[model samples]
Target: MPNWVDGHPAESLSIKDRGLAYGDGLFETIAVRAGRPPLLEYHMARLAEGCQRLGIPLDLQLMRTELLAFSAGLGEGVAKLMITRGEGLRGYAPPPVALPRRILQSSPFPVYPQVNGVEGVQLFPCVTRLAEQPLLAGLKHLNRLEQVLARNEWQGSEFAEGLMRDQSGRVIEGVFSNLFIVHEGALITADLSRCGVAGVMRAALLDSARAQGLKVEVRDIPFEDFLQADEVFLCNSLFGVWPVRSVTGHHWPVGPLTRKLQAIARDLLDI
Candidate 1:
């Protein structure tokens, strides 16, 4: 299927579009199944928050309509939705009145080894550290040079993902996923108040854990504490959850809690 720009099928974007010029936008990677996005509500909620935070005007109703139409055409795949501040002059100041641009692109779903979701995977420790930016924290903003750099630090299938940390060496997240650790029967994930993307799958898992009466903690997790976790797992909108087997010299078993939450995530993603 062709890409949609501002709700119509298209092939190219304007040269002056702010998203291209300055990374001035937000985006969501949604998983579509049977002509529908299973996590549409979660994706939209984050997009709404990002629009409000960036003062970018967005029509949620219209976006929803377009997304539904786009997903129907693609059927089973991944839908990438980008909302830009639209075309702008060559400068830092945004246009006095912003006209947000909506872009939708389709791609085939990723194919990972079945062992990743079953037997578990290893993580590579990335040298690139995330910068502290409270204003952009958790928004899934378009500026992702940090993630790009971290992702490139690795070479092959030996590591399924790279573990990213903040400037202070606080364990934050994965290259393209959220991290969660189970310790002494409580679920803990790093707080994104200062950095990191607040992934939709992470939100869904938190909600499901809470609903199931599991102890969940969204707080700052130190590297030492993370290494001490009984079980660790990574999650994203597309891949559901993957039990983390090891990182660096330390190691961890694919514990029962990881399996339980993995089951919840699989159910949520309908995979």
Candidate 2:
């Protein structure tokens, strides 16, 4: 992977950096294909919103210029941008003047099996539940210890992804992807007003699906109701889409809606 710090080639960050000290940062994982980031706007918009909400100063125009330059020679891969609150003293008090640190990284696209999207994949129900934190909900902040713990609950190919639930026992999302269930001819996804990362792919799909006259509901989906869905799928900026064949004991065949949405995602990603 290639990395850059503050728009320059660098490999290390200070130990006093708030990102390392207190996980005080936000990051975006962008998919780059054919030397372009198709959904750059969505990623940038989300990042900007997080910055504003957290009182972090970010130069979006400069970040955009840097992103384009970084991805220019890269054909197909992933680009990660992390903005931290910068170095600070040994206490929790914020510095009077903040100088945010920008770290950009480029890596080769992850190799996933073709069948993961075509034939679907199995999901493991994680025991670790997401804590309700409305303040931090929907933002891709640096605190991902919950996801890391959930992911560690499983190993190997038996389960392609791990499903996480909120403290209320409502299905929230996958460890590394957003969850969507199709039921009664409508698309249903979890409400991220309380928890979960509002993935860029999920946002794009919501718009596209509604534009096509598809019924889409963004609300709390209980575990029981989720199991009764007609079809299920997971999505992220990198993987595109993966139909959920089964979660725990419940099984769902890849339905037409999943395929339809997958096609839309492919077009949006220009794949």
lDDT of every model, 2 decimals:
0.95, 0.92
Error of 1 at 180 (Å): 0.2
Mind giving the per-residue lDDT tens digits that candidate 1 earns over 81-187? Answer: 99999989889799998899999999999999999999888999999999999999999999999999999999989999999999999999999999999999999
lDDT of 2 by residue, 1-271 (tens): 6789998899999988999998899999999988789999999899999999888888889989988877776667998989999988889887888899999888999999898999999999999999999999999999999999999999898899999999989999999999999999999999999999999999999999999999999999998899899999999998888999998688999999999999999999887
RMSD of each: 0.7, 0.9
lDDT, model 2 = 0.92
Best-performing candidate as measured by lDDT:
1
Task: Assess every candidate by TM-score.
Answer: 0.99, 0.98
- Assess candidate 1 and give its lDDT: 0.95
**Model 2 — TM-score against the truth?**
0.98
- Collision pairs in model 2: none
Alpha-carbon shift of residue 262 in model 1 (angstroms): 0.8
